[model samples]
Target: MVRKKGVYGIAIVALICFLLIVFCTKEPDTVRISHNFQAIEFEDVDVIGEDISIDKIIDTQRLRLERKFDVFKFVTNKTFNKLSMLSGGQPLRTIIVTTWRSGSTFLGDVLNSLPGNYYHYEPLLHYGIMQIRGPPHADTAIKTLKNLLNCDYTDLENYLTFGMSHIYLFTHNKRLWTQCEAYPQYCWNATFLNEFCRLFPFQSMKVVRVRLRLIEELLSDKRLNTKVILLVRDPRGTLQSRRHRDWCPGEPDCDRPDLLCADMVSDYSAAIKFNKMYSRRFRTLRYEDLSLSPYKVVQDLFDWIGINVHPEIKEFLDTHTTVNVGGVSSTYRDSKNVPFHWKNDLNYTEIQSIEATCEEAMKLWGYVKTKGPKLRDFNPLTSYTIK
Candidate 1:
């Protein structure tokens, strides 16, 4: 009888240990559910919470869950949102349009670092695809656009129900803009443009920051808020950089008569003509200003758009300084030498041609000219004297 009793006691002890092990191994179901739901929310809208038949109670719970998730997402990704908050609900609609190698990538990286701003690097690709392909169907397009804009269709419809009144920054690669009209079949697809305009009837603002003769041709679209920034460098420096570092495939050959060096006389003639035509709306900032004191110029630009500078902006500027081909440094190693190294690579004739072509732009932007003739009334690009 004693032996049997001892054996029963041992059996009880073993059963308790097994139960404890099982409980420890199992993860909390609630935590698992929450994580899965969040992942689903980010990927697609249809993967939300389980549906409850009762309308009122289910709707309230779903709203609560969404709000909770939104708060979580914001906390996790506060950099962009911080900028949006600084704007007091009027988020920046910035478009960093530029010709190849004009330091737009650098500018974009800086803007992207700011909180609350949605920075799309080369968004023109998406725009082109949509325009050419049209939406898969009306429903799919509506859903995608709403997601892209981060707003509901109802909100967008209400905003554009009236006439065009809002400010939209439409930044594009200069190459894309140049090709849109001339090589219509190559880059022009009206489906996206037509739909976007029809859906959102707001004035489209463009950023033209390169020294190109094509600027005048761009003005045919009267509705464009064409702001030009004739970003220029010393002719010697420009050509050298173009030859060694910044050569883009499929660009016009610099040797061709029609395709003069970007800094040549023809380029300046085009810039001057464009500037005169859109004098009131045009603005220019030098490549030097961008390299040296980017924050000040960018701040002024933000102010122009009525966005008050955040006090924390100084902190961001102090920390981020390196400029690379990809724009911002993904790593913290210092890289200030990248921008100034183009001076060592150009030949004399190349330098002279660049200077000859870009003389007008150089004078306009207050660059000290080396070989080109000076303009009589060459106003500094930043000489926007407010009367």
Candidate 2:
């Protein structure tokens, strides 16, 4: 009996000590998710849970922004915005500025390969054949772009609908397309599109219509937090690829290498200027270099745009760059050999015309000018580096 009592007393003391120690030790007040650039964040929280915090953040952010945000206004009327990156409310916005047939579709897909992005394919498609040319159209261009970037589809209601020249636009956005396919009722409903767009942390668009000078104002507005990738291609290769398009011949804006080179000259000057001004935000990528080294170029591109190369982006690079060329508008290509494939399509006479017209760009952008040689099959007659 005495031994039993001693053992019980010892056990009780140990239990009490453990309880006191646990009570005295401080527990952390809050925890953080490892990554900060996630869908949403919390300013006040006792516990950190993604689902709970994200919903509260969304409601708070929407209410705060709704006060200053005008439904149908733009850069000319209302200034861009003040939301921080994905960390706060706004998603990162990037525009790929390139001419048609310059592997822009492929490059756009590279950005789209990031897990969650609201991909805008050729937003200027609504502008039709006569792209944004001058003052008459400039305001409209800026306004439209601002609205789209901000996920405000108020004015674009007509263009944002289904079946009438908007199929391609929705279909290109895999996530949106999937949801739309699943729920046809919400396919292009302005409300659905707006909400869907907000869910993403990145917005990517490719525009062949606007010039660098035109977008200077858009980039100036820090609130938009816009970045640009000027994707330039050798006119020789550009014109060759453009030949595949039946409509390009008659459109001066489309096929004429001379006209294209002139635009490039104007844009290239602006590129140099923008490089000095917005070194972190603006990038110039040559199609040849991208094709020659897709992995390295894309990795660098991701870093420049404030992201690491995502696994999906890596898989896209692997599968898309190495596969044989697909449909005319398809992103898949044997990227390594696509640069010089134009040589097989164009004869020396055609090459001379393209080269002569693009001489200044070729020289400035570093393309070795071929005088009278007929080395059509020789891998890219023009060097891919800048002089």
Candidate 3:
């Protein structure tokens, strides 16, 4: 009886070892790939030789598209608990709360430039598969975002499931999206994302969907070690930029000031409340101020958030804020003059419409009206005088 029991115990150990090996080497589920999934692509280049001029993008799109895909298997759960990560003394949770065309993307690129920071660009891009439709979806945005910032990818399975039709969604985190760039299969695998997300020390995500009031939960959540940055822009400039994206909405929402200012007014009120409560955890940035004085404002911003300005951000600011400008969605721009670009484009009539609708926001947020004669000359767009 004793010999038989020993043989049975040895058999059980062998079975357990075999199971572990099989689980480790199993092929990724192919059903994870969607038949209707749209292809996601980003423009990039490869260096062919020692010289920069000879560099060219290795054209792999054809080959990449033609190949069959199997999800990339991910292999680690090396993440520490949020308490442990934060108590060890430095993984700060920073979130950018702003709307599109408000220079949020530009600011996002700036913040993500720092090494050791893992950036989740527009994590709320999954609402209805693009952008958040309205406040009714606030709960969804809030829950999903908190999960993302916490490095919990369980809730993000669908968002990362098919990669992203919106390239900027992940491309902003160059360190991350590269893994999915070649074979989107990697992005579809939640296990891969779960492990990838935990590898970063500083986890940050910028969101345009939810309002400032909605962000209060995150600020109050101690487990997150959270900090919020509210970035507001002059309504005129935001509307003007939205006009460039003619295909996008131009109504009581995106391009229109009525709903836009309503949202801002509510957000500003929350900012005031949050400032009094979580002073260190909450801060606001005006796009006009940052654009007008990139270096000073950014450095002050970094200091406020207890982070040193990365050298990469300086190079980014130099490259993007100068003559190397791009289109409506691109982050590249003449940062100093961008805030006033709308001044040259918007006529008195258009300005009147926005200013009238956003009167409360403009006054409360310190954006001076087009009263002075030099309005056309790009005079001071902001003021210390808050009504």
Per-residue lDDT of 273 in model 3: 91
Give the TM-score (vs. native) of candidate 1: 0.48
Quote the lDDT for 92 in model 2.
Answer: 71
Per-residue alpha-carbon lDDT of candidate 2 for residues 1-387, written as tens digits (9 for 90 to 100): 999999999999999999999988968656533321111111222233433433453454344334323442212322224232333467778999888888898888888777556788887777665545568878887777888888887788546753345688777776566555444665666766666567556689998888877888878989888899999888888888878877777887886777788888888888888888888898888888899888999888877776656566777777787777656776778888887766678877888888888888777676665556666545554454321
Per-residue lDDT tens digits for candidate 1, residues 1-387, read 999999999999999999999999997553111212101111112222333222332233334434433543422333332322222222234433344345555565454433333333432222221121122433443333333333222333332322122212222222122222222332223333322222211112222222244444334434333344454444444434445433333345422322333344444555566567766444455555666665778787555543445433444455555433232323221334434444334444554565566665455545554333333333223432111
For model 1 the local lDDT of residue 171 reads 22
Pick by lDDT: 1 or 2, better one: 2
TM-score of each: 0.48, 0.75, 0.73
Q: Which model, 1 or 3, shows the larger TM-score?
A: 3
Q: Best candidate per TM-score, number?
A: 2
- Residue runs of model 1 more than 4 Å from their true location after superposition: 1-91, 125-239, 244-250, 253-282, 308-316, 322-338, 371-387
Where is model 2 more than 4 Å wrong at Cα?
A: 1-88, 161-163, 376-387
- Worst window of 10 by summed lDDT in candidate 2: 36-45
The residue pairs that clash in candidate 1, if any, are 79-115, 80-115, 80-116, 81-116, 83-115, 131-192, 263-357, 263-358, 264-357, 265-357
